[model samples]
Target: MCIIFFQFKPHSASAYRFILAANRDEYYSRPTKPADFWENDCNILSGYLVADFLTEEADGLTYLKKVSSEGHLYNGFNLITAEFNNTKGDTMCYYGNKSGQEPKTLEPGIYGLSNSLLETPWKKLVYGKKLFTDTVKQCNELSQESLVEELINMLNNEEFQLPAPDIEEQGQDFIRPMLKEISALFVRTSSYGTRTNTVILVDAKGHVTFTERTMLNPDANQWKVSSFQFELEI
Candidate 1:
């Protein structure tokens, strides 16, 4: 299943002036669910806020409702408005902003997923790094205040390297169940003497995803991927 948690804070006096921020999650078995697609967006729930006030009855569609909120969703993403509704009536409301702005590219950090009140825990997704799964687990195991402080510290840590994969060619007539698993793959292209990198992360299930590249040195003549890092969640 997919779930989205958001925080909103007002930035101005206008009725529509608010900020929207959120994180999305999908089950491993349900990779195509809503959360996976809307991963890092601030505008995922705007339609509901402008149309109607969400209530106990609006379970299947997104709408806006006034309730206690956790994070300042209105201030987090510099959003104007958002929507919330229980389209499926599972007691889980779908919320997002009206104007769509992708937050994944803005910065690398950890995002928390929460219910309407923003006090309860749902799940968390880590962005721009290979240790996402582990980080999430650690956060879930910490005290509320400790989790917040630790999470911020983790996000603030200097960007590290992405590891390289082991590549080999097999003989034309040979077949091998005896192949080594790819540890990691660091893909980079250099042109104009400047390097651009894209980190492809592969989970244990063999699913591959991408991450933003962090340059190793500021004083270096040109930027290049320093390394690729990998870790098993188990």
Candidate 2:
């Protein structure tokens, strides 16, 4: 399972009018896929390359929907994509499980998700909402660069870090799997742990910046940060 959480600010005084802070959480066993926006962005969602599009939804959310993939669908993705001054906020999000859940339009707001369902919690505990609200309040006015660092820290918060004892005292029956699930923004399930943190920001000026911090090993505490900048209308 993967975790992708972000904040979208379309109108702001910051350099990046659109600020997106997100992390991709998966087992150390899962392979990592780096983001690319410096050169060509050829992200294929469902079936269509995210770069190519021109369509409108019933509610005016312009996007092309593809239910089937040319091959097997990649299931380890929790993605939130937007269309800009390319396709209506051209925003489209897809959780790994979409057997019956159809794509729907979304208004501007903060959101987060893991392996479970889009907004529905798989278990009794889900902490994305609190993380979203807290981060937004603290980082809303920060520059794109500063905002990225702040979000990464949230993922590595020790308050809810794995193997927590406080959770156990909450009553084993109540917090068993739930404690781990809700605070799983950063996970270390034996050999699996968070591997990367990414932040993407764009502005009305057609400028884009994508910053990534990758862990060398599952247990390794260090990260190599890479920042990419380019100009695009969307």
Candidate 3:
């Protein structure tokens, strides 16, 4: 399972217009690559690249809608797309096919998503949203480095909460046991656990900072961190 928490405050008076923190949980033995820019498209950067055929003029939200319309062809996923513009402000949208809800634009505020759905109130999602909100409230007081550190710490949180009864009941027979183990913000097990944590910040000036921390060797507890900073062109 994976988790994402974010705050979108377009055209706000504060320094940052967007803040995002996420954790990617997977089996330790799973083959993975670190975050980096694509060779074919140096303008884009991500831990993994998905080839999507779309016109260059299509924006993030547009691409999201296209994916939503074809959601039935793919497995369950929670996708959030955003377009940040200093002049025109910003736009964010959430689409969860499992919820059977149409793609909708999100208002400027904090939001969280886990394996279930958008703002599903899963134990980890609720806890992470609170941590995200608290960090955002102190954004103006913290430096950029401090802000990143705080967000990273929030992602590292291991606090756990039992899943709601309804949630537990919805799980398959074999999935029920795994549910309790993954309830924590940071999950760790013998074979599977959180493999990476990522934080992204886009300031009012259109400056973007992306940082990713990955587990290099789970058994030895080795880790690696990579960061990239750039100015948004649009």
Give me the candidate number with maximum lDDT: 3
- Best first by TM-score, ranked: 3, 2, 1
Clashing pairs in 2: 28-192, 83-89, 83-90
TM-scores of all predicted structures: 0.22, 0.66, 0.92
Higher-TM-score candidate among 1 and 3?
Answer: 3
Reference-based lDDT, residue 205, model 3: 82
- Residue-wise C-alpha lDDT for candidate 2, range 1-234, written one tens digit per residue: 356565555544445456555555556665555555323324321211443332323222223145323113565333344655544344544423354444455566666665555554532124645765676676547866666777777666534545645445544674465556435566555555567776666765657777787776544566778888777655
Clash count, predicted structure 1 = 30
lDDT of 1 by residue, 1-234 (tens): 111212221122222111112222112222221111123443222212322332233422222233213223553222122222123111123333322422111111223332221222311112222233344345335543343344333433333222211112321122112111111111111211112222222222222232222233322243332322333221
* Candidate 1 minimal-lDDT segment of 10 residues: 185-194
In model 2, which runs have C-alpha deviations exceeding 4 angstroms? 11-17, 29-33, 36-64, 68-79, 86-99, 122-126, 161-182, 217-219
* Residue 12 CA displacement from its true place in model 1, Å: 36
Q: In model 3, where do residues sit more than 4 Å from their true spots?
A: 49-55, 163-171
lDDT string, candidate 3, 130-197, tens digits:
98899989999999999999999999888777755545665567446676667788888778888999
